[model samples]
Target: MPDAYFLPDYRTIRYCLMKHILHGFTLIEMAVVLVILAFLLGSLLMPMSEQMKQQKIRNTQQRLAELKETLIGFAIDKGRLPCPASTTNGLETAGCGDNTEGYFPWRTLSLNIRQDAWGHPF
Candidate 1:
């Protein structure tokens, strides 16, 4: 071994240890990373949510079209527009049955309306 007097530099060793200790992430660094992640996630999800909404709208419109076609067909079949029934019994009533309830044709067309993706009156 070299002379015992030639000891390693403790100051440099302490400096290197301190540097390593201070090299960890700071609060600001973590906050910045979180902010970036949030932005990326928001950008990714926004288009997906919008696409889902558009799909729902398109599905609703398609269902409405089909309902209109069924209504027209029913009219042609009976030579008149469908009328609402007195009750769930599917009997014709004084006025048109609740078209909104899908009972205009004695609930026969309810299946068509229910097929819509959103399953709303529209």
Candidate 2:
């Protein structure tokens, strides 16, 4: 048989492959990216947290007002003030502690029981 075609140089191919293998992020670079992302996310979440707090405050105010109206209606219908509840669960319908006050839940109407976000009583 006659001489076959000469093969291309393998060294160049190996060098290019090595370069490609080295061209990627190191562990340190990946860690830095993660840290930056965490910082960005934390900063963004702060404002959202504040907004959520304000929303909660407004909701609490509205709910308290509604509770006040309900208590007033209950009193008018039954001819007595709504009795104070032992807790702030807001679902007490059978009076609190004892049956002395005609089954009125008043814990929702107390100014001292309710508190603002700053931990002060409403």
Candidate 3:
């Protein structure tokens, strides 16, 4: 066996141990970090989706208010309320006595709106 004098000292042993430990993060550590990042991103996205839905609702409400005002203005101008529009086209019908429910007369009103915020007919 070699003499004790030829063996590695305690300082050399400690240096080698620290070098290996400081090489890089382990696979398990990387996976844990990725999971934490995913959780953070998911939390942020949920509220953003909810905010988008709220904005759509607000837009729909504003459009409905505008339509009500426009209808009132039309009644004052023509001395009578406009007739409901036909299903095939958005034009006002000649007679409204038979129809209780129908499309809005956007064409006759000279309005460009054809649908609501959710892509449904006004």
Candidate 4:
């Protein structure tokens, strides 16, 4: 009797088991938290996306204006508009001022932006 181990009684063991089993949040609570996090992230990100779109629009507009000024400068110097580049490639596909009508001579004028932000030729 002096060497016997002191085991916990059944009532205490049951109480400990129940406490461990009920310790954490339920599955529904976790789901609700995840839903709330998703809503917060979505709301935070939406305005940023719109601002990015607006910035792109502003950039395209600036590029277009610069392109106009460059063309005017070229006309003043050369006495005629530069030839249109090929639609397929960005650079001037033919000789300069050969058929300078349809497209902007971006390559001939040393301009880098061959197309607008929307991927259409300037």
lDDT of every model, 2 decimals = 0.68, 0.63, 0.85, 0.78
Q: Which 10-residue window of candidate 1 scores lowest in summed lDDT?
A: 97-106
lDDT of 2 by residue, 17-81 (tens): 87776665466588889999999999999999999999878977875786678767777887976
Residue 79, candidate 2: alpha-carbon lDDT: 92
Top lDDT model:
3
Which ranges of candidate 4 are over 4 A from the true structure? 1-25, 88-103, 118-120
TM-score of each: 0.63, 0.47, 0.73, 0.65
Give the TM-score ranking, best first: 3, 4, 1, 2
* Steric clashes per prediction: 2, 1, 0, 1
Cα lDDT of model 1 by residue, 3-115, tens digit: 75699889999999878776664666888999999999999999999999999889878877887888788888879776654455554455544352434343654443444
Candidate 2 Cα errors over 4 Å, as ranges: 1-25, 77-79, 86-122
**Mind giving the per-residue lDDT tens digits that candidate 3 earns over 20-48?**
77665566588889999999999999999
- List CA RMSD, all candidates: 5.0, 8.7, 3.4, 6.1
In terms of lDDT, which candidate is stronger, 1 or 2?
1
Give the better candidate number (1 or 4) by lDDT: 4
By lDDT, the better pick of 2 and 3 is 3
